[model samples]
Target: MKRGEAAEDFPPLSPKACILSSRSGSRMNSTELGHRLIRHYPFASESLLNERGIGIYVPPSYYRDENKRYPVLYMHDGQGVFGPNPFSNSSWNVHRTAEELISEGLMEEIIIVGIDNYGQERLNEFAHPLQSSGIPGAPDIICKGESYERFLIEELKPTIDGLFRTLPDREHTALMGSSMGGLVTYNIGFRNPHIFSKLAVMSPYFVRLDLNTLREIPFYKRYPGVNNLALWLDIGEIEANILVEHVRGVVEELIEQGFVFGQNLMYYEVPALRIPRRIGQPECDRRCCFSSGSRAKQLKPSCTAEKKSD
Candidate 1:
């Protein structure tokens, strides 16, 4: 199956009408597994796009250490990340997962922002502009990716940095997403290297676009800000079967551009883990921390990390 084919078919959603549990605020109220999940409902923007929700997961140390600051991870597909997202009812359960990891000392404490996707507009917002070489099954998507990128960089990011105690530098910042979300994560990370240095692109829907067109994007053409990045790229066993060539093409290009596979750039193929949320379990979380301009750790089982030699 093409990436995000299942999510794209779901009905459109109005931002105000979705996730109505709380009001927009500076306070952190929601709780899961001893961590705070703050809900900023109807997070309005100056742009024409609908007002979306923001789910912020503050680490356990957030309250305990008023003087301490944590790194931030900005994630796409906000709704389904922290808990049962409104879309698939399957969530990344990031709150619980991160709590476990922190307690076990597997990963450091960081603030995770879940930026909600605009339901039906997800395909358009997350997609990169493709020429006539778009994939056969992929729809003709008008790339609002630039606008979405602006929302994260221009709007939401400043708000989070100002309100929360974040490191606020490119080295301490990261971006992660799955499927279509994954596609945008890589795009935004590459384009805005000064903003985010760590990237976890899980089951990226790169197969939706022609390999040649993808290679022509700025990161490939100019290689700007890529070397400063610690990128974790992965595809599911099933998805890998379909996108092996496309995924491999991107990996090979990154290698050619001086991304040492097991060191700066990490690539993996996970078996029996297809669901995007499940694909982002603790293992991925651990690697994300390892990628966050910190010491690298050994990868876990069931996930294959490939090292490419120049």
Candidate 2:
């Protein structure tokens, strides 16, 4: 069996069982466990493309109340956002984290929408046309980020807002992802500031393209002010050396362009963990690192790190 294919056969595990297993020796009733499972819409079809659908994760409280409205965060790599799937070697477990945050009152109840990338077209769809230098044969790939963004803003958001009780303003909306997804979220958020006010980018794959001198992204020319937005950026200590340098360069550029610390933009760097060899195969590990960036945020200045074999 493939690494993530097992996710399909296994039913959603009860939160209580998971929690109880973690706790010393506590037992949880089935009814209590059922209540903890969030009301989620799996593979929700996009209005524009009926065949391609994104996963939706609503908080546990969403079903308990009808009048409550919540903030919405749109994330890329739908399969990796919540649990194991074809696209994820190790899931971020976002649902569990969000539930814990809500239970602890660290953050308000919010809705998470995970958008899946077109498997083969993922790289092309996520990259900006101007920045295509680092990617070999990048010209051969069709750049459709413009249309993809439109699908999110013009088609998907409207449908989601109409269906659920959401805080429809930009300030309450956030966009996030890791690797290429991170780069895309940054591109879209900066280009369409009126649509997204918060951005969470992790280990962004900015090296693949060279758009201008790196100092001037076309999006910056439109929205010069960064005060209106909140940004969270992070990277792992160990990854490909080139990719790490690329991420550092992007962060430095953002800082140079008026992204103040703790005010508008926040950056993090997490230490790398040594995984068992069985799960450390090249492709599987790539997704594992990307998924890990979503949950671990320990910011540090760029270090002189050695590169790992790809």
Candidate 3:
């Protein structure tokens, strides 16, 4: 039930192969729903540890409302976000869910960008650079996520912004992922408040709650360039249960650092469950996102307000 346990077992994938790897004919299922789920290959990159493909989900409104600029949500583990999982043959169906919400007027129109992991290197690339103590189940940081973070800020975001009609500001952009991906989301999202102002840290394996780790976190004071960030943090029953306490520890630290609940920071947990606002409702999206059976409007807040970098 650890972060990398389930998906990591897949055989190591070749970076070159992944560049060409993509789902069959459904490439860009220009669906009847009016939404287009497009998969583009050969997204060559040198800054990242591996060169890979990109999956872009353009909302129906993007096509319908010609002049509008949409917010962009960047997600990790492209395969699980919307397509069939190689391991379980299931998927997040994010495209369908987002479409429903937008159509129902429950959420704003937005674009989704999914980044495929390079198999084994996923853990290394996704590792958040923070280390206080070793996590029992979580793997130790291998590559320390520096390259991955660079790939996101330097190579990936710029490319995505250029090609798509994105808001291109911190407030209009978000970063999300679960488990290990969640850890890196905080590292990248919180650290780079000037770029990504929103974040969704679901079932993050914070690993070490030790004093040393807490001291290393830079959120103790109001960080410059991060004036108005809306953050969402949560965990579930099975896979996330093991790391729940650590998750709480991180939240407490954030709260002490001045992130107000119900305003900019929202934390949800239940030996039992899962945000609520029309613009960035976490509760509405919980069922739509975590539960396979449930559907939108699931609004997972995963972006940041743009700020001038210091």
Ranking by TM-score: 1, 3, 2
Model 3: residues with Cα > 4 Å off, grouped in runs: 1-35, 131-140, 208-227, 238-242, 270-284, 287-310
Tens digits of per-residue lDDT, candidate 2, 196-233, equal 88887767766643445343222111235554667776
Candidate 2: lDDT over CA atoms? 0.57
Q: Rank the candidates by lDDT, best first.
A: 1, 3, 2
How much lDDT does each candidate structure score?
0.68, 0.57, 0.59
Query: Which portions of model 1 show Cα errors greater than 4 Å?
Result: 1-35, 130-139, 209-225, 280-282, 291-310
Which candidate wins on lDDT? 1
lDDT of 3 by residue, 2-85 (tens): 223321121233442433333342332222212344554445556663566677777665655668888888888776666675
Question: In candidate 3, how many Å is residue 263 off?
Answer: 1.2
Model 1 lDDT-worst window of ten: 2-11
Could you give me the TM-score of model 2 versus the true structure? 0.68
TM-score of each: 0.78, 0.68, 0.70
